[model samples]
Target: MKKLNMISMSLFLLAFLGCRSNDNIEYQANLDNAVRKIHSDLQKELNTDVPSLSVYIVSPKGTYFSTVNGANGDLMTRKTYFRFASNTKNFTSAAILKMMQDGWLNLDDKITAHIPGTSISYVPETSDWNFKYKDQITIRELLQHNAGIYDVTNDDSAYHINGQTYTDYMLENFPDHQFSATDYVKVLSQNNLTYGPPNTVYHYSNTGFSILSEIIARVYSQKSNASKTYGNYMYDHIVGPSSKTPLNIKFPELASDKQLPIPYIKGFIKYADHNEITNQKNASAHIGEGNGIGSMEMLSVYIRSLMKAENVLTASSIQQMRTSKGPATTSNYALGCTYVPGVGYGHNGATEGYLSTMLYDPETDFSVIVVLPFWDLRNMNNFEKCLTTLNVTAMEAKKALEY
Candidate 1:
């Protein structure tokens, strides 16, 4: 999906996802019934109206829900393509954990120490990003997005919004758009990019993760005595164990031919006249620490591995990834996911058009994988809502699961 669909998606979601609807009396109904209704709506979208759409509602442990709707409607059961946008952080964080265990680096080590082309002047001005600044951010801070060097309101940056492409805009308008992380380290090795003190605030910066990716590439080359890049290293050590791969994040256009599912809301988008956001059209060369394209089954495969405690990491390390680093945008952000109180740690990704959410609760011995086309479809699978409604309707669904 592309950012071009945000305005429409947002409008649709806002209409149905009530500000107080979750707490409404009628919402507190039976889970199976809720699932059934969701299933029916999904059928309408997939089989009748929304043929280009796909939806998934996997049980916590990866069990298939009887309500998934796709191209084949009730008969379709394929691993449809999906967009992970920003959810890739979880995998990156896990790779960091593996690197840490190998003693190649320390959580407190300065980022410059591992990544070669880094410098001092890259630090920002008019601020105290020096003390807790340059050499202070740790591996943990980088993992949890609390490095204090983030700016979402920077007008100089660009990302897809509404129906406009922002990459070219950044390239043309903001000369500093090229002044990103790894590139910053290379050309401005004598400088650094610091906003505030390390560990002090949680400002989300895709820049931070990009730098981490660079560091991993450098460290793996040296430690393994093979000059192997981070991309290859992650596959061998990190994703290989869990059996997942980086998505095909090449070009993101308005229309796609990759056979990925595409569904639209009838009352919302003018599906026939809409321009497709083709991934082949918008070639995002390297801003991939966030959005990557793949199939829904892959997302489920990765999360299910985590649920089984599939030896992907040591028990202690798994706990570390799940542990909240500090004050994040929410409760506490672990390396990749966030710790939801009374719920498990998980992260939500809202890309231009795709929305993917996954969470695992040890307390309930379950997990949830909800993937939808638009971030705001009123006919959303409502997997998250099922969590809060556990005491009312979802409890019955849990009981009926025969688990």
Candidate 2:
């Protein structure tokens, strides 16, 4: 369960065959066939289940194709906003990398050097093993999921309801609970546990990204000398400055009245049971981990701008962001982005109801973003599970269009 929900969307493409660069008549014919297959696959889902889709693919030249599949609700268009999940990590890391480029912080700087109230701040002299390595963790380690930090979302006692996991509990009980990013980090610190020693291995933890968000907040707070937040910095700097168009992506506050933009698709839980949890109260708890909302068109623009090295980061900074540090694991993840060996760089995001993927190959300048409908938690729960195949389908489309 730990690895399943948070797994990179590119997992199935690990064994993907060689790229086909031939853009001939035969290649075009094959590409058409592949698109037909994908469209048909999505049609099956729209016919029986979810009612929203916003898929946009771009090639090296420019806009390749954009389509709005399924039935669009009266208010829901392909432009409807939805959660970006762990893909939010990309934005957070990009912001931190930008800060590093601006001489505000360095990747190797100790996490405690920035965020003072971390577990590293409270080093208790006891036999408890989980509390030992807090002081040794670095900012780079957290970005790479090698911080050895405890996962509050999955591992914390506070996240457990009765015996079931919090996500499962949410599916069943529909509880209205909200927690701050500090609450999550505090749970990790107080629990005195970690995946492993810092920089020794890789373990994906949303808690680590939440810590990054807090670190970003602290950095911005110090620089501005005011009570600013990570969300404000993201809008004012990250998304706002980079885009050539007006993009509306923001980190929602945990305040009870806060709500996602309307006209969005409702995400489901169990497909067979037909359970729904759209716009739940606590969807915006941890800012950096997986709590971003935006439309697919704007998100694609943000990614393309980054790939073209337009305004997000300098060429050198982009290289720094792409360079892989030690203790690498699956997906060959750098600070925030995932690599496809010699192919491309991208990431995937999944929460309770929404699943999204974004991949861009700099070599060919091909980018694909897939926001699959209603997540199926259990592998055997649904016959036509789209999340399992969305990444591969998007990749196939990329390869086809490139050829």
Roughly what TM-score does model 2 have, to 2 decimal places? 0.78
Error of 1 at 74 (Å): 12
- Show where candidate 1 strays beyond 4 Å: 1-62, 66-78, 114-132, 151-195, 241-275, 281-288, 327-330, 341-343, 375-403
* The best candidate in terms of TM-score: 2
Overall lDDT per candidate, in order of appearance: 0.49, 0.66
lDDT of 1: 0.49
What are the per-residue Cα lDDT tens digits for candidate 1 across 218-327? 67776666766545665676555433443332213212223334422211121333623422212132333553555555565565565456735566778878874765
RMSD of each: 14.5, 11.8
lDDT agreement of model 2 with the native: 0.66
Model 2, 115-217: lDDT tens per residue? Answer: 3323322122233323437668888888888877777676634446587654446435754555556665555556555677897778788878877887787
Best by lDDT: 2
lDDT measured at residue 146 in model 2 versus the true structure, 0 to 100: 85
Can you tell me which runs of candidate 2 are displaced by over 4 Å?
1-36, 39-54, 66-78, 114-132, 155-159, 166-176, 241-246, 341-343, 378-385
